[model samples]
Target: MTALIMIGAAVLPSLILLVYFIFGDRFPEPLGGILGTFFFGVLTVIPVLVFAAPLTEVLQPDLLAPIARAATEGFILAAIPEEAFKLAVLVAFARNLKAFDEPMDGLVYGVVASLGFATLENIAYVIGSGDGWLSIAILRALTAVPAHATFGAIMGFYIARAHFEPARRRSMLFAAYLVPMVLHGLYDLGLLATSYSGDIAWIVLGLGTLIIAVVWALRLQRRLRREQQAMLAGTAAASLAAGPHELRG
Candidate 1:
């Protein structure tokens, strides 16, 4: 029963966020494509775990002091690799779908991949807690799960815009990777630093970073949604004027 509770606590948050992100899409992507993306998203965990091993060994590197080494763990080691892999999956797998016609699709699929990774990641974290598993599970459900979703939302916003705007592709792609990477790194750093210093302020910094990220992503999503709604209206108008049977892509 405890094992089941652990799994539930881990899995439920991601599922809730996944539904929240995708449910509002005007034209949804196929169920199979979404599932496949989620599958690949879950697979991203393997590489992240493998990469963390080497970084752990180098925790006391010669060039950097322990403090600096600790700092780099958040931004350099954790953020960069994790965001890079998630973005790769977004581009290679999610972007290629026939239905990825608008910015919304990018946002939707981004949440899918991120949540998939979150669900699996959470299970491990919660289950490993041993005695205080419930607290860990609840805390992460509220914090980590939402943080990841917002990150994905931010990534998808820029990448999807890049898809439709060729002139700004270079900058868009740069923001797509960089914004989330920085946010993620900072969030991790707050937690890590708190561990070392025993400062509750570090927890505030981390949660503050997450709250800011969430707000930014929500605003971006709303703006994107409005833009797409206008596009839909225009397309519908054009289609009706053209003829009844004239299909629009």
Candidate 2:
């Protein structure tokens, strides 16, 4: 029972986020594609572990000063590798999934992919806490998991635009990788710094980073939604202009 409870708490946050993101869209994704994307996301852990462990052993981030350590761990050790694979998975699914028909699909798939990775990562983290696991679970549910969601949303938005906007691909792709990379780095930086330095200010910085990320992601979602609406309206207009034979409606 204790083990089941532990696992449940670990998994619950991702489930809630997944459901909420899917329902928030007027067109929710098909179940099989969502599950498949999530599964690919979960598999990203394999690459992250393979990538980060060797680098950690070589760099020894723990021995560095708090701020330097935070930067190294936050960006080099965690965020870059994790986000790289997540983006890779998103790219793969975007090419393969038929449901990925709009810019909003990018946001949705990006978030779900991040959630998939976060779910497995969270479970490992909570279970690793041993008997006193509730705190870990609850704290992560509130902060870390949601943080991943925002990063995914932000990354997905740009990557989707990059795909659709060939002329803007260079700039859009840069934002896709760079924006989330910085946000994830900053959030981890503050948290790790606090842990190492035992400073309230460090945590404040970390929490503040997450707050900013959340706000930014919300704005990105709205922007993507507006673009998607315009695309749909344009398509409708084009079809009507083409005559009744070509109209999808």
Candidate 3:
């Protein structure tokens, strides 16, 4: 009974975010988004579980002692498998979809997929910890929610750019994929550092990364708005110019 409650608390907020991302947009509607997000979430867990052992073996030897010590249970145990799984899910399920219509839609769908992943993942974490509901709720709200959302938003931004600008699609795709990896890597590194050094600095670094990600996302939104406005203005101007010629013809 207690465990179920704890799991619910952690998972509910993430679920709300998922609902908003799916239903809030003026796109195809909630059903497809829900299906996409949920399917990706379930599918990602398979590879994560299957490759867990090999990934640990490969990453463990190469990692620095401090980081290794921090991840003594295993580096891939927490970081690589989870991140790779999320990325794969996004790529497989959401990318190249026609429903990804507007630039901001990238952010929306990516976030929905991520929230689905986070919800299940958080439920697992809370249930495993055997911690009280309050702790689980607070921890997920503070850490997991933003982290997953940011990663998805980052991916979505680049995916949207790639879709819109065919000439620069490859570069945009690269940035979209690489940026989230860097953010995820840095976040894990910070956790590892904190464990080894017992320094609060690592926590600060992780929080700082989240802050930076949010700021970057906001800037992207604003930039997209400006670009959209410019496109609309251009279209209107072209239409107006063509009107005079049509009358003469």
Candidate 4:
């Protein structure tokens, strides 16, 4: 009962986002969007474990003891694997989707995929903690849920540009992947530092970084909207200029 409550809390935010996507005009078909989110979420975990398990074995006992000592369990156990998984999933599934028509669609799909991951992850955490539901709920709400969502948003923002703008596709794609990598790496590093030093400052810094990511995501959203509007306006004008006979609509 307690575990279910915790999972509910953790899943709520992502589910809210999912609802938004489903009802919103910007998203693809409702069924496709929902399936896309679930499919990518499941697919991401496999590659994440594949890469992380070997890395953990190599790093923990054999090499770089000092660095290992400094690193938080979360860094080795969660951050690297999770981020890599998200990237792999995005590349494998999202890049090929026809729904990726506009820049904002990138953000939409990215958020969906992230939400799927967060939902599953939240369920696992809630079940494994064996703690009271409230505690687990609070922890997941404060940390995991937002972090995963932000990571996905960052990736989606850039991917949208890469898809829509052919001439700058390479650059956009690079930035898309690179932005998330840097942010994810910093998040892990900050958490590691905080755990090692037992310092509130490192934790504060990590929170600040998340705040910045949010701001960046909002700005990108606005920019994408403006660009999409402009494109539509231009298309409308061109059709108008073609004369009434050519304009079937």
Candidate 5:
């Protein structure tokens, strides 16, 4: 059925990304913790939708100019509030877990939260499309879902970096919030531009922005994975040298 396909479209991409990041982790997180983070991500959407309506209205102020209003909504209103809430959820619910031991954990939790948000958002968009639900679902699967995952990856990378390298915590913490916020704003701005300009060029710009965002995130993830792998190796060597039963206490 169409509804089933739409659901698949919403969930499958998130799951694929989730699996990719989860497996890449040198220290696997607890399944329950990961699911809880995902659930919190779903919960964050409610606040985003509720706050976004008023925030957009307040930020725009330009009631008569459609393009200006849309652009403002995309960059200032929606991006800031949405990513802010996602960061809040990460800090409040996911960050302090005992399983959050390494840099990869930050990436895992960030992606989990982002994918959860994307999955719910995707379902709504797909269903609202009515007869065109399939096309809508497919389009979002390729674009929006991956975008959220990449944004989350950026957030996670900085968060873990801040944790491991405490001397640089101040800068890394700021980046944990700012990088994703800017990227989200840019992506949304490009999408809104296509509507305002009615030019295929806007679509090209949007796709280009997406490619850059994804590449940036991937590079960060790879670097973090390598660092975590080395840390894990060092920990294992220390543990073995300490003797089998002589655990840290």
Candidate 6:
């Protein structure tokens, strides 16, 4: 019973985020495609582990100050490799597909992909926590899972902009990677440092980072919705203009 509850707690948060992001769209993506993107997201862990393992091996924590060590582990060892692979998966699988016509699609797919990654990570953490799995599960539900969703939203926001404005792909692509990378890194840095030093400040900042991520996601959702609505309204107007005068109604 305990293990079952632990697993549910770990997965439920990411699933909720997934459902919210999917239904939030005016035109929700096809269920089949969303699941496909999610499957690809699950596969992304393979690459992250492959690349991250080597870097982790090389980065000796004793050589640096505690703060610097935390930052290096979070930013360099974890965030860069993980976010890069996720960004690649988003670009490779969904960016050019017919389903990716609107900005909202970017948000949808990005959330899906991020949730997939979070789900896997959650399972690992829960199972690895032994008798204390319940605490680990609850803590991650609040922190890690939502953080992943926020990073996904950030990546997708820029991806949507990049799709609409191809000329700005270079800069937008950079933002897509940089924004989440920094946020995830800072999140990890704070939490990891707190774990090592027993400093409440780092924990507070880490939680603050998650709060910022949630706010940013909400704002991005609003922006994407507005853009989608405007485009739809323009299409309606153009269609009406092309209709016969008597049929204008």
lDDT (0 to 1) per candidate:
0.86, 0.88, 0.69, 0.69, 0.83, 0.86
The positional error of residue 15 in candidate 5, measured at the CA in angstroms, is 0.9
Candidate 6 residue lDDT tens string, 1-249? 777887788889998989888888988888778888898888889998988787767887658778888888889888998888888878998786788888888878888888888899899899889988888888888889989998998898888789889899899999999999999998999898887777778987788888999999999998888887898899999888778875854
Model 2 bad stretches (over 4 Å): 226-249
Candidate 5 lDDT at 229 equals 78
Q: After superposition, how far is residue 149 of candidate 5 from its true place, in Å?
A: 0.4
RMSD of 3: 4.1
Question: How do all models score by TM-score?
Answer: 0.90, 0.90, 0.78, 0.81, 0.89, 0.91
The list of candidate 4 runs beyond 4 A from truth reads: 20-30, 61-80, 231-249
- Our tally of clashes for model 6 stands at 0
For residue 210, model 4's alpha carbon misses the true position, in angstroms, by 0.7
- Give the alpha carbon lDDT tens digit for every residue of 56-144 in model 5: 56765366365575568776677787788888767777888888877788888999988888889888898889988878878888999
Give the TM-score comparing model 1 with the true structure, all chains together. Answer: 0.90
lDDT of 2 by residue, 1-249 (tens): 998899999999999988877776666789988898899999999999999999999999988987888889989999999999988998777535888877878888888899999999999999999977999999999999999998998898898888889899889888888899889998999999998878878898789989998898778777766776787798889877888665554
Instruction: Report the lDDT tens digits of candidate 3 across residue range 1-249.
Output: 877678678877877766654454433334775577667865666676777767557666445576565554333465556656666665666765666667877777667666767777777777776546587678678876877777777777887788778999889877877787677666666766786778878877677777787677667656766766787798899999999999999
Return whichever of 1 and 4 wins on TM-score.
Answer: 1
lDDT of 2: 0.88
Q: Give the TM-score of candidate 2.
A: 0.90
For candidate 4, the TM-score is 0.81
Error of 4 at 107 (Å): 1.1
The C-alpha RMSD in Å for every predicted model, in order, reads 3.5, 3.1, 4.1, 3.5, 3.3, 2.2
Mind giving the per-residue lDDT tens digits that candidate 4 earns over 1-249? 655566677678777666654444333544775587567876677777777777678667334443354453445666656766776666677767766566677776776777777787777777777757568777667766777777778888777778778899899878877777667666666666676767767776667777777677667667766776788798889878887867565
Tell me the spans in candidate 5 whose CA falls farther than 4 Å from its real position: 57-66, 235-249
C-alpha lDDT (0 to 100) for residue 144 of candidate 6:
93
